[model samples]
Target: MRKFRKDNLVVEIYENRIEMGNSAAEDIADKIKELLAQKDEVRMIFAAAPSQDDMTSNLVKISGIDWNRVIAFHMDEYIGLPRDAEQRFGNYLKKRIFELLPFKEIHYIDNGESDPERICTDYLKKLNEASIDIICMGIGENGHIAFNDPPVADFNDSKLVKIVKLDDVCRQQQVNDGCFKSIEEVPKEAITLTIPVFKRAHNLFCVVPGITKAKAVKRTLEGKISTECPATIIREHHSAKLFLDQDSASLLK
Candidate 1:
């Protein structure tokens, strides 16, 4: 367990799942309160993954959170999947967060039987109009951030959102998470927000849990800034923090 401080942001790691979740929720609630006190609206981006389950659930339970003044955005979605599909990222967010809150609006990538390019363009426009107050995300076992797999990650990518091919590791991860029945059932492609968009957030809270993520977490935290480990870029962001339970941080020296 360690804390990393960059400018006004503080990232604290915990050795316990319950402690990590509780601390992250409290931090998020504090940030929301601070934002609401100074602005009429607050925009946030959320990652939909099993690792975020506890954090999102606790966040929704926070009292005095002005959900009516909040606009929520999701990180990425598999291409060619229906929004209502069991494997859809949209369904995950709806079941875990949006349905549990009174958010003013929730924007998600429209990967539901639409033209891929058109969906990307629409989401790019929506992100441009939003002033993201916080972005909550998790690191993949492959060290990928969002769908920006190691092979395709670009720190200076001009496109806010793009279609990306899922690497083998990433596809297998979805299967392991039970989002799909098997590796072959996972989509090969997805539309994801680029690194620049993630870095554009006023604050970033990265939650990583489980032994499966230990290697990736260690590399990302103690690695050189490069596309090979996309999450390493978080270390460069002035307002980014990483939260990890003991299992995820186990490999860190």
Candidate 2:
């Protein structure tokens, strides 16, 4: 593994996604342990994607974490998927980590809500109830963090969560991840936690792997911080660590 710092962000490159995931999960587990020592509960937000599979799987295997004192929340969910659809972000996280661990609370963004705005307001209330301690996230193939695609991301976003229209590249990525059969099958709209929400988190652990993310990873580390590549914003975060595998870091100079 190799490590470096870019502004306030720490970057770690590992031999493969498995190694990267293991290190990231270990670091997060340590953080959780540390926080639990200081407080009664630890609140975290998670990103659901195939890219996070290794990390989430490893996280559940690690001992010493008091899962009973952890409160869980997912970062985004599709706007129109059926209640039981496997493609829904909530369901994805449910299978990945939510059910694997016994968390104190698990707040899912209801994708089947009849009113998007109403659900956003409701979720915002839940988020604001306490300060978020950590965010486990990933960069999209288009350099988006969460579902805040370039076109919709706002660094100074006023809302904690809101609805967004998925850009072409973002929709295509769902297909590339095998979450949907085709771009047409992907939901064009989603409810996502805004950039400001991530900025407010105490720590951010962004795990991004795979060759398909090379360009996005390059942009996030080397490009000027801008919404054009929303992930670039992490460079300014005070306690953010980006974990990458060789294939994902291939385009980095």
Candidate 3:
């Protein structure tokens, strides 16, 4: 593994899946334990995607982490999807993590059956009131972070959450991940946590795997800091780390 710092952010790149997942999960559990040692309650943000499967699974199995004292928040949700919908990101988290563990509170972006702007406003208000201790995320094959795809990504964006149209690359990635049967089946719009909100977390753990992510991973790590490759802006944060399996880090120098 290779470790470095860009500003205040700490980035770590690992060689393969087993090591990457194990180390990332331990690091996350350790951070959570540290926060609980300091206070009664801790807040966190989670990303829902296949890239996070190993880390999330390992995280729930770690003992003495006080799952009940954590308040969980999610990163994004597809607009207009029902809570019960198979494609719902909220439902994904509920099944994969939240339902298995107890949390003091779990706040999800309710993009179903509400005016998009109003939902964003309400979610933003909730975020502003809570100070997030840790955030777990993944880098997209398109170099997108959260739902912040290229054309729409805004580094200086001030909104906490907003509706965004899915770009072609982002849509195809969903198809590739088996989240949808095809690009046509994927939702066109989503409500996403803005870059500013992601940057606010005290610690960020970015887990990226698969050979398909190799090119984007290389760009995010080696390219100029810009909205084009949204995840590249991690360089701007002080406490972010990137965990990559060999497949994803293959293209890196």
Candidate 4:
């Protein structure tokens, strides 16, 4: 692994996605162990995506995490997918990791709620109820963190959770990632945890892989800190670390 710092962001580049995932899982496992030693429970937010496959799989296989004492929350969910829809971020994580573990509790955004306002209010309450310790995330091909795409991202958003319209680039990414068969199949709206909500977490880990992300990764490191490229904010975060594979880091200077 090649490790370096860009401002306050820690960057670790690996030979392949597998290696990057393994290293990220190891760092997260070690951090969880350390946090568990000091507290009775640890609250963590997880990002659901093909990008996180290697990391979450490796994390679940690590033996010492004591999943029984950990609380899991996902960062965002599509606005209208059915409760059990495979594309729903919550259900996506459920099939891949949550069901495999014994978490203290898992909180999911009720995007199925008829009144979107109520869902956002309830989720915000739960989030503000405690301090979030760890966040495992990914940068979208469009440089979005979670679903905070450029058009809707706000660094000082007052509401922790809110609904936002998905941008064309963001919608196309779902198809590119194979989450949807085409852009039309993708939801045009989503209920996302605003950028401010993500900032509440104490430690953040962004794992990005593949050449598709090479441009976004490069912009994150070199662009101005603006919502034009929301991922750029990661560079200003004191406890944020970005893990990248050679392909994803190919465009980085």
Best by lDDT: 2
In model 1, what lDDT does residue 92 have? 85
lDDT, residue 137, candidate 1: 94
lDDT of 1 by residue, 1-253 (tens): 5786643445577968778988888888899999999999999999999999878888988899889999999989988666678678888899888888999988978744468899889888888996789999999988999999999999999898999999999999998887888998899999999999887888998888888899998888777778999998888787877888988888877
TM-score of each: 0.95, 0.99, 0.95, 0.98
lDDT of 4 by residue, 103-184 (tens): 9999988745688888988888888888999999999988999999999999999878999999999999899999999999
Q: In candidate 4, residue 138 scores what lDDT?
A: 97
lDDT of 3 by residue, 135-177 (tens): 9999998899899999999988967789999899999999999
Clashes of each: 0, 0, 2, 0
lDDT of every model, 2 decimals: 0.87, 0.95, 0.87, 0.91
Question: How far is each candidate from the true structure, as Cα RMSD in Å?
Answer: 1.7, 0.8, 1.5, 1.0
Which 10 consecutive positions of candidate 1 have the poorest summed lDDT? Answer: 4-13
Q: Considering every candidate listed, which one attains the maximal TM-score?
A: 2
Indicate whether candidate 1 or candidate 2 has the larger TM-score. Answer: 2
**Of 2 and 3, the candidate ranking higher by lDDT:** 2
In model 1, what is the error at residue 168, expressed in angstroms?
0.3
- Model 2 agreement with the true structure over 12-81: per-residue lDDT tens digits: 9999999999999999999999999999999999999999999999999999899999999999999888
